[model samples]
Target chain A: MTRRRRRLYFIVSSLTMLGVATALALNAFRENLVFFHSPSEIAEKGIPAERRFRLGGIVEENSVAQGNDGVTISFRVTDTAASVPVRHRGLLPDLFREGQGVVADGSLDKDGTFIATEILAKHDETYMPPEVAAALKKAGRWQGE
Target chain B: MANWHRLANPTLFLEWSRRVRPWTGVATAALLATGVYLSLFVAPRDYQQGDAVRIMFVHVPSAWMALFAYAVMAVASAAGLIWKSPLAHLTAKAAAPIGASFTLLALATGALWGQPMWGTWWVWDARLTSVLILFFLYLGYIALWQAIDDHARAAKSAAILALVGVVNIPIIKFSVDWWNTLHQPASVLRMDGPSIHSSLLTPLLVMGAAFAGYFVVVLSIRLEREVLARQVRTLRRVQSRG
Candidate 1:
């Protein structure tokens, strides 16, 4: 093949690869955005009934209580400025406790109780995920501790 | 300046890398020593994770390097296939194991860190799964090189696989954001300024620099060895002809 023909082939293949990469990047950006709303945001603009969404915040101090059955638990989640009461049944995550970072997925009742179907507790002390940190900051509750 | 591709020529690489080799080695040693000290001792404990956060200095850099090394290898393979350059193929071949080792380091460290934080040793999360695939792709690339005895054929086939595998790079990067998983979102790189405290960012960045520097030094050594092997093969062919 002539040098010109070989150059054309190289150009075409490189462009194809570039095109594929761009497509994947855009798809990833669009699909991966799961909006995690903090308790303050939910308080300001309410979540639709039965809308499954992620709610995260610090577990409010002195709000954690074990029911008579022991498996049922109740606590208030706070973004610092506002707190939402949450009632979760079943086993709590190993890291779940009062005054720690947490993210729960469930829906709100008309009475404004967060009935968490699934609860996720942060692993480290004073450490919440970056998303949790952002929500907390936005709610004016960030301790940065 | 556009003649930068000429650097891929084996003789040119040999001459240049020889002169710079000792400096790269010294720099790699010093930077790594300092990085280790800073990451382990000098960096303040994270308010939350405490000592476990030190793993970030090692894990994040290795994870970054694993992606970086594959990109380098893929580009080198492209050069080899496009220009029919043996030197480019050898460079790409030399880089495969290094990339694989970095991927392994990232995975192993990630598992150890995850155990305490996530309360699990492994998860089929998107980020973790994509990285596991990357590690496999590295192994496959290396295996392809050995499976084919003909140098030209082996390089041609292996280059195609490397090019195909480039799709996974973005997936690995975006996996945490794309799906709900146990892994935390990025701290250092974001549209907003890094939310991580400076105490953590300092050692992490320094370790990242040290890892990149070490890759260059090791790649140069591997490429030098590959070039020498080629010379030996050529000399034997001449002797047999004589």
Candidate 2:
């Protein structure tokens, strides 16, 4: 066989092995790789109240309310299939709003309310002019917050 | 193979690249000018993000270029290793700093965009972390090239590193899908057409093209320098022996 052909074979086989190895490794550590768990996942899996974890989902519409001090807020995070109530102190991010994606970190209380030490807003993939967005809303074509 | 050999010749490669450099430079300037204008003045504010959304115009393109340049470097590294092409090794060498700069730019701009939007300047989420790994890989590749005294050995080691690091590219691209990430999933490169409206998408595409043109221009200039530097090294060695 030619030297070129031999080099080609070596490269191809090594690359394949590397890819398979990565795939297997990623698959094995899938839970650790996940940044956050949805309400449904947490609920279905019966996450212990003591385990510190991140709960992520959309901030359900009309589910937000202010605590007596105004420094604390309570809201429900939902994946439509399930919703987890979350209580957060201090200020929310600028982008935080109803019908917006959020990821909150902390453990659940005995009542199952997530006590968040940190709140992070998650942006969706959609982008458009405000005017276009308004028109979509007016036409009932808007699919996002 | 003959045609490949002809192009591989340093003198011929220099001649062709020299002819192409000015055109690429001009293209870079023109496209960047137009893209910036469109992004800043023409594109409307986002419904949610308002003015902050404009950051994506710069952030997305730099991130795209970061990945694109690495892909170029890895391919060149492969060619260098497989074919023993002098031009290919130099091409990979030329691309390292440029790709690293883009990766850094992407990370910086991402931080700028993330602070207000995501409520954090950084995260160890899959998408963000993988891109950070890519930046480190670029740094490691550049360090390998500099640390080795023997040019041939340096090139071979760097090529192997580049090939291994190519695995991160797909990981970065798919990280958003494979795991939950705060950085958001693919927008423009989705199966369903781009989620961005045309007004926003046009400027983004223009900026992407501009970044590509800039990469080409810089890569050619650096490649040309690498060729000349190799010639000078060879001449110095011969003169010392004489």
Candidate 3:
């Protein structure tokens, strides 16, 4: 093959590959972009019934309650400005407690309570975890004190 | 200056990179220093989380670089295949290991952070799994380049591999959203703008810039080294012929 023809072949092939890869990336990110929202944002915007997303805040003190079923644990997650009730049916994290940062991934129930499919305890006081801190601070509910 | 042919010469590219390396290195160091200071000490601790948030300083940048490095490699690979430019091949070759290193750093730091917070060293969650795949892709690309005996053939094969592996980059990114995984989705580079507060964002952006600068500095230096190595080999061949 001539040099020109080879060069043309390379260009056409590479461009095709590039186009396909980029398209795949954009498509995936679009469908799966789960935004982490603070309790305050969830309060203000109101949780979308259909979209699955992450809600982050501190578990409010004395708000945790165990239902008659014994397996269902209900608690309130708050950023001080707003609070959302969270109900979980599984074992809680070792560090799970009141006044601790928690991120719950699930959707809000029709009555506005957050039904968490999975719960993660945001660890430690002196060392803030990135995602929780960023979400809280973004909502202007971050208490640095 | 406008002609693509001018950049086709490895010797010319070497000289150009040599002039740029010093500035790139300086900028990288300066940005890193500023980013570290801001992220570690200056940034306020969360009302809830105290100090562990500092890990983001390292984690976020490394993740960004991992993706950025692969993008750079893919672009260079495309250029090398299209123009058959020796400089482009070197550029792609130099970027692969560096991108891999960044991916490694991101994974390691993520594991460290995850352990303390998530109570696990590793999970087969979608995000983590996708990143693992990216790391493997980098390893495969680098290994493919090294496995081949001939330089031209190696470049061609590696370029093809890179183009193929480009599929994984998006998969790594969207895995969190697509699959029910432990890893969280992107907050910084989202369509609705960064979900992070300015106090936190300032440091994240600074660190990101530092990581980008570091990649450029290292890439240019490596590219220059590869160009010189190629020139030396060509010269040795000509002398052997004489």
Clashes of each: 2, 0, 11
- Model 1 reproduces what portion of true contacts? 0.05
User: lDDT per prediction?
Assistant: 0.78, 0.88, 0.76
Candidate 1 residue pairs in backbone clash: A32-B178, A125-B48
Best by the DockQ measure:
2
lDDT measured at residue B185 in model 3 versus the true structure, 0 to 100:
60
TM-score of the A chain in model 2: 0.77
lDDT of 2 by residue, B1-242 (tens): 45678889999999999998998899899999999999999998888899999999999999999999999999999999999887899999999999999999999999999999989998778887777777777877776676566799989998998998988899889988888888789999999889999989999999999999999999999999999999998999999999
Tens digit of lDDT per residue, candidate 3, span B1-242?
23568667776777778888898889889999999999988887654435656788899899989998999999999998987777888899999889989999999999887766665567555576567667766776776665565789989999998888887788777766665455656777767777565777789889999999989988888888888888788999899999
Candidate 1 vs 2: which has more lDDT: 2
Q: What is the descending TM-score order?
A: 2, 1, 3
Give the C-alpha interface root-mean-square deviation per candidate: 9.9, 8.1, 9.6
TM-score of each: 0.71, 0.91, 0.68
